[model samples]
Target: MPKPLPLFTGLSAFPLTPADEAGRVDTDALQALLARIIDGKANSIGLLGSTGVYAYLTREERRRAISAAVEAVSGKLPIIAGIGAIRTDAVQALARDAAEAGADALLLAPVSYTPLTEEEAYQHYATVAATTDLPLCIYNNPSTTHFSFSEDLLARLSKIGTIKAVKMPVAKDLAFAAEITSLREKAKEDFAIGYSGDWHAGSALLAGADAWFSVVGGLLPHPAAALTKAALAGNEAETARIYAMFEPLWVLFRAHGSLRVIYAAANLLGLTKARPPRPILPLPDTLLPEIEKAIAALPER
Candidate 1:
């Protein structure tokens, strides 16, 4: 039998997938990145996630990346691999591939080109959950998938035994706090809620989110962990101090989505040569100075 599922809590490092100048997966560089994440003391390592650029890779390449990551981790940190695809069958196949590659759990997004109904979305997850015994974390990223799960849909999905967690998107409004509190109350007692909006992670934690499925945390694991540790400990002074260091990076993220900013950060930090997948190329030359300045501005811990 596979290992028991890990509780969805604490910081999870989501490093951008490393690719060479030619856009091929760089296994050596990826391994180094995974080792660094473990060293930073993150609770888990999330691969093929939004930050991992899974939607851009060929199936064979994704499988190889998982194998390499599993080998590199060597059980140092639990690996939660994304298995999302537009079609249900395709998602199931990816989930199987991830399990065979030794991933501990699956992170799924209900991706669709045509709009998906709440019923369709729920069934998509229900079918996928039935296909595997491995725990699944439903990824509700409306910005990318353009399909947001309603509170009722989420409640229904949580009843699925293998559906262990949800990667929630925080609304960018003053009511964000109330939204998290209400969602947490509506979710199953045992179900874990993880927040993905990097900017909202601190507030989400304070509002009782169980985990931070973070992009910035993936690369800047030490400070990310420090921020999360502070929140969990209720140390507002420490939290504010650490969050201030990320203001420069947050500016870039707000301008361009996290993937672009993270690739720039990874390159600046010498962690990887991770250019965003084609069609989502590197931020233009005009942004290079900003990326440099943002990284340079990072406080010396």
Candidate 2:
């Protein structure tokens, strides 16, 4: 029998949306940046993910961004739209707009102001699933969402008819690899486990992650693919070499947030001159030299 397909596998490039100083979406810049990502050979495009600052934008802004992204790619790739919201009704509406805008799939995190019970979380997902037939990827980023998903919760989520994968935030080399195992035991065999710890991607992907839902991939898709390919091929030497090149940027990501660092890197690389959301400011000028040095090390191919 043929092997089953991987969950959101390959390099799912997570793009940082470009906007002007006025905080308006720069459709021209967005289009240019997306074209570069596609040219870089990503398997799919991750639009409006955490890296995109989905939480801070208004509902209408979110919709317009999706429309621009859908139009920009022109169906050249499958756009995985992040529709994470604290309210189910908002998430459902976002899901509708995503579908209408031609997104290939939806990703949601259980973003809540107040604490949520496991049942409440499950119901939120189930309710959103009912809004669209687009396959859902459960985004388990406790760092931003402030809610951690237990294995039991993952198991229940896996059973949702429309849910196909889980974007589990990981710590790179060690614990992330174990999460793939533990999550599998709790979830179904098909529930694809994707990781987003940019620092240790090589070790995690080599260890058996289904997808490298990456920030670096969006910035430098070609080199990121080279690394992921090396890891997938079990070519440890190549993977290690490429990962080392990324070490400096990863250090910055650890110090500041990847969201801010990536925006700065994008600006430095001439990809997006736009800054991140209000509270999440640009990488400090003092850090620019370091970021520039790190970016210079990224292999173009």
Candidate 3:
């Protein structure tokens, strides 16, 4: 395969898919949300990521979301479509659809249910990489995928020529930092690594992560973009200032039973409707005050 496009750098936000009370994908809400992000000057938009509830969406729904985003964005910023599935065929289909939808790249996670041998995993990515002309960003969220990509596996994947980036979300701060350092040293010059775990965003940038994919970015694009700019510009003082402001929101995301906290935050900012799809409950009425307090405390852009 031809070499993948260079890894996308800078801040990318993963916005959730807002649904209506009838449990349907709300296109108007989605277009409105994308407009908000673009108007906020977000560097890029990553849809169908974990925040978008990709696993729960049907193939058609996923395609609709990508198409809506592509139309709404209208080339204002590159769209990184999340093409994750437990089956290779499903992933390749999603990738092809995303490329046709005009996405700049695809964020692919390993097969979810069965743990594949390293070689199997390699072939899985290679298959999708070959099937789509879009660049690929290997998403490593072992917490959800139940398996981490070993350094050897990553090193080998980097050589595929179509794998241009890795989004490493190792939970441990030190280990995440070390992996970014080592990956930067060993990977090919064009392959960039991104950090997705919000807690380590500041440190990861300092350690040479090319960019960050922020869940918080969906709720507060201005601050997240500011934080990324500050870090990239070597303005540690500004980075720290923005990070301190974002700390509470990050803490809420970490607290148990807080997916709703995130959803609520997004709603409060008018990024999306507060309701998650069925099976995932909305935030309790009691938590609204706490969510509001955190939002109110956020520093102004």
Candidate 4:
């Protein structure tokens, strides 16, 4: 079968594929988690996102996780595989692996290392785009990779035939708005635009982002999906209600940290037992009650 196109609407959650205590990927748990998201009617599931600990995983491990996720999904929903590495060869390998493993599209990002010139960054994506037939989405998160795609770069990247979207972690609203407008004018007809910063999700959508990439949705797919639907439907009342309920959790995530806070919240919700991989420590005990309280306050399904 041909690779699926990038999904640009509705809620797409970046889930942390559960791993066993032995550090082996628990395929069964991965499938089960995906099944829950699918059954919950989420629009899409993003595998190997930052929360998936993609950087910590070896190429082989990521292959296994993507294969298991694709098998579990069985085409029920679109799967966007995260393909990011510091080296061009490694990124190409991951993209090739995802295409072979039945992933629908790729969420490509710059590898964490010394920053690249805009020309080098553009070439990095162009090379990957040439390597994989599947549609590609550039991941822009300066906080993690220390590289942000400028409007000029994004406008140029939009001209590539295979690059169909961008996942920008909007660090500044004014800058993001300008970039979005420029991208819309430059991108292909099918190009999708999205923002990853939860703080800016609502505003991003309001400012014309086609969809959102949310880590919160990974923990509470049902509620998050509901909120997105509400937002898209322009149900201000419902959107406000859900946002209010989930705002506390978002606040904690922003305050504590990104991947770390997400893993802690997942553990609190009984989703996984695995801690953040080496070099990154687990959440402190002092934060448990606060997390629990925030979760408990979420509106009932």
For each candidate in turn, the TM-score is: 0.93, 0.95, 0.93, 0.93
| Model 2 residue 265 lDDT score | 86
Compute the lDDT of residue 77 as modeled in candidate 3.
86
| Best model per lDDT | 2
Better of 1 and 2 by TM-score: 2
lDDT of each: 0.83, 0.84, 0.78, 0.81
Candidate 2 differs from the real structure by a C-alpha RMSD in angstroms, to one decimal, of 1.8
Clashes of 1: 1
Q: Candidate 3: which stretches are off by over 4 Å?
A: 1-7, 21-23, 171-177
Candidate 1, residues 87-163, lDDT tens digits: the string is: 89998899889999999888999989999999999999999998878888999998889997888889899889899
Deviation (Å) of 76 in candidate 1: 1.2
List residue ranges in candidate 2 displaced over 4 A. Answer: 1-7, 171-173
Which structure is stronger by TM-score: 1 or 3?
1
> Candidate 4 lDDT, tens digit per residue, 1-301?
3222448566788888777544578777678778778877788888998878788788888999999999889999999999999999999999999999999999988875787999999999999999988888888888788897887788789779888778888646447567677777766666788878765576666566678898877667878788787777767677777788888888888888768787787787776787888788889989989888887887535
Lowest summed-lDDT stretch of 10 residues in model 3? Answer: 1-10
Whole-model lDDT, candidate 4? Answer: 0.81
Give lDDT tens digits, candidate 3, residues 42-150. Answer: 6778788888877778788888889999999998988888999989999989998888878888999885676778888998999999987777889988877877888
Predict model 2's lDDT versus the native: 0.84
